[model samples]
Target chain A: MNNDILATLSITDATRKLATKEISSLDLVRACRANIERRNATLNAYLEVFDDVEAQAIAADTRRAMGEKQKLLGIPLAVKDNILIEGRRASSASKILEDYIAPYDATAIKKLKDAGAVFLGRTNMDEFAMGGSTENSAYGPTKNPHDESRVPGGSSGGSAAALASGMALGALGSDTGGSVREPASFCGVVGLKPTYGAISRSGLMAMGSSLDQIGPLTRTVADAKLLFEAMRGQDPLDSTSLDPSFYKEGLQRKKIGVPRHLLARGVDADVLKLFEETLKRLQEKGYALVDIELPSAGLALAIYYILMPAEASTNLARFDGVRYGLSRRGESLFDDYACTRGEGFGPEVRRRIMLGTYVLSAGYYDAYYGKATQARRTLSRECAAALKEVDVIMTPTTPSPAFLIGEKSDPLSMYLTDIFTVTANLTGNPALAVPMGEVKRTKINLPASIQLTAAHGGEATLFSIGREIEAV
Target chain B: MYYDAMVSKEEVRALAQLARLRVSDSEIEGLQKDISNILEYVGQVGSIVPNKGETQVLRAQNVMREDILYGPATGLINKGKELLTAFPKREGDYAVVRKIIHKDE
Candidate 1:
């Protein structure tokens, strides 16, 4: 097969071929490598394409020859820089960990490895996964493959972009606050932020411990399901990891709840139009679209910003020029930490750390962090109630399509991109971003997406509905 | 728009210090503006109908397990040298660090 055909093949299609011996893992990896060579320089998607990928593919082929029948065998997938693969440089696009190598594989990566997946390489991300756009990557920004002048929608922008540009069949990205979904939306791919605890988080560099979920980014809902299945379930390393029985799966009502009140404004007109069209298509397919009111949905972004930073601040304390990562010596111990971190971390990370410190500090803890937690509980309750009535809650994954590379200079405006996606993170529900269609911007067609969020452990429902939208 | 609570330049420096990050004088002004704007926006959380002590529901749980050889994280158990290689300064088998103890000069 030509490299383009192999590189562009969905994980589902590629697996079928691999199973039949119609395609070798070596050819698949090389096809992906061919695309990476063609476009990686322009897209800046992969920070490092693994040098041993050829050997990894050969090993998988040998395993297959020995009667191994793993579904993901020999499949090449792009991994976010934050998901640690042992012995590989797992920089979260931060300078501080420039030389740091993962001593252990992240549970998700381990599961993928066991399934016989190939690691294409680590893709770029915002430093510490702090920003909505990959522009904040200490190394540099990952440009959208659709429009090079635009962003791929961040934190996981590189992973999304890599897959979108055919560098890999699928990719892994961690979503703290819409990092995975928003980029998936922008890059015209399917992104799933599985229910919190559905997948183990061990060895994945911590961001917001409560919100971070390592999820799959793929071209099709089935492809996403394929990858999510291999990596999901309990691991002793991540106490938060769930047993399959944690949340009882409910019957699908063939209903979707749309919080239209919150979407009255902020969402771009074109994007909203496409969203309604998708709803109409689903309705024509015998699905009910109910207008649900989630009052707290309006505050989801505000709550996410406060709580995520608070959790992040505490989570990041491990990087104080100590046991691992970059270290700097100073006249005193304190100076050593201050200098090391100040030089190592990028601006967005510093901003979040400071924000977290301020919220968790003695004086403001109750007013900011404490209040955000209360609001979070309320939001979670609201989502649970809504999901009980409907199979999934729907919204535009992002307020608009991918914006120009330097468009959202103001931090607040840049944050608005995640407005529709953060609710799931806050509520611990699974959300999927599926490309609805494209909207024209600046005379070019840019991808727009629809977000469908299901109740905790309702990923199966999400996959079904996501497939519906993909059909639409 | 009014910011009920604002982070001044001095407070930005203090927060940076508390976070153990050294920010240049130039970064303080930007941090002050950006943080103040964010705090003001996120402060809207205060308007949420209080969940009446329900905030504790989100409080973290102790995830520690008995010290034993088990689980995937055990992959880190014997790779002491690889972990040490990431340390910026190390002496043979130990990570070097600055001493805090002082004697009367």
Candidate 2:
């Protein structure tokens, strides 16, 4: 295989190559390392590239030579720093845990290692996965590979960028809101946010635990399927994990739902045109398109902000600089607690934490946090009803294509980028972002994407339809 | 509605304290202006009217399984130490903890 192919090849192709001994694991890891060195300077995608990756690749090759048949043998992948890899810093891109090394491997990391995937390095992200863009990352923002001046949509921006720029064959990203999908759309790569409890969150830095899920970012639909099939399953440690039966035997290209009303508003003309064209192509390819309306879609952003921040405030409260990370010296206990957090967390993280604290505070709880939960219930019900009619709901992943770097200083505008994708997260539905060719006429190179959302335990439909859509 | 944009400087300070964030007076001024703008935008959510129905609570109850607790997982400190070793600062056996708690003497 060519070096470029080794670097950018999807998981399925790489696996076939490895199985056939067409390209050795050493070649893939070395190509990935070279790609990282070439692009990461501008992209700022990785927090660290493990120097010992070649050694790990060698070990995987040794195992392959020994006749071990694992699904991910000899594949190379990047990991988000939030997920623990033993002896690696799981910073979560937050200064509070800047020094904290994982005592043990995250269950998913352990599983991937067991499957024989080589760890390339860790990708950067928003501190504790707080911000919509990676601007809140303690390390620095991961720039979009398409245009270095623009943001690679965040908290999984680095992972998406790595996949988009051919730095890694595929990478792992966590979705708590639109972290994975939004970035994938920005970078024009495939990203999946599986059902909330589909993958274990044992070592992932908690950020709204209910909404947080680790998913895959890859070059193609089948590549995503390969990684998903490998990483998914119930883990004994995570109580929220369901039995592994939910994701099995997916159907091939079938009827897909298009929520015209939900996707019609606030979307750019070019993006909307691209979305309609995607539908047309899918229809031509024999996939049935059904018109569906989901009114709860408008309320998704509001509900997510409320619920996600509330959980985040609680989840982030554990990092007081008492255990690890940057701590400030103080005369008294209160000063120690206050000073450390005040100095450690960035402005965006502090803002969300404050907002979360406000919503969950007394008197206003019933009005804000409580009511948001009720809205979430209604949203879940609406989505469930909608899914019953259509196997998968499709929409533009983002309202518009990636904007210029430093274009959106306003938080509201930044949050709106997730408008199309966040609902799936709020309702715990599985969603995937797949590129649907480029938009016409701008030097911007706007890549349009269609989001495929499946019902709870409907990842099978997602993967099957994704495979079909990709083939076309 | 315009008055919503006119946030008081004192209110911003109080909110910061309530959120346990330390802020300088200069930062508070900027925050007051920005937060006022944000609240004005976020206020759009107030338009949402839910039906008169029993509210569904999604409170995260402790999800600990009924497994036997063999006490805290031991030797995790060594792992924690390996992680903390990368930090620029160090004290002793314990990762030099900030004075976050007070014991009654």
Candidate with the greatest lDDT versus the true structure:
1
lDDT (Cα, 0-100) at A330 in candidate 2: 65
Candidate 2 lands at a TM-score of 0.92
DockQ of each: 0.63, 0.36
| CA deviation > 4 Å runs, candidate 1 | A247-251, B1-3, B52-67, B71-73
Q: Model 2: residues >4 Å from true position, as ranges?
A: A248-253, A440-444, B1-7, B43-53, B59-64, B69-105
Query: What is the TM-score of chain A, computed separately for every candidate?
Result: 0.99, 0.97
Q: Compute the lDDT for candidate 1.
A: 0.90
**What C-alpha RMSD does candidate 1 show over the true interface residues after superposing them?**
2.5
TM-score of chain B as predicted in candidate 1: 0.79
> Clashes in each model (backbone N, CA, C under 3 Å)?
0, 1
Among incorrect, acceptable, medium and high, the docking class of model 2 is acceptable
Cα error of candidate 2 at position A463, Å? 1.2
**DockQ of predicted candidate 2:** 0.36
The positional error of residue A375 in candidate 1, measured at the CA in angstroms, is 0.6
Q: In candidate 2, how many Å is residue B86 off?
A: 8.7
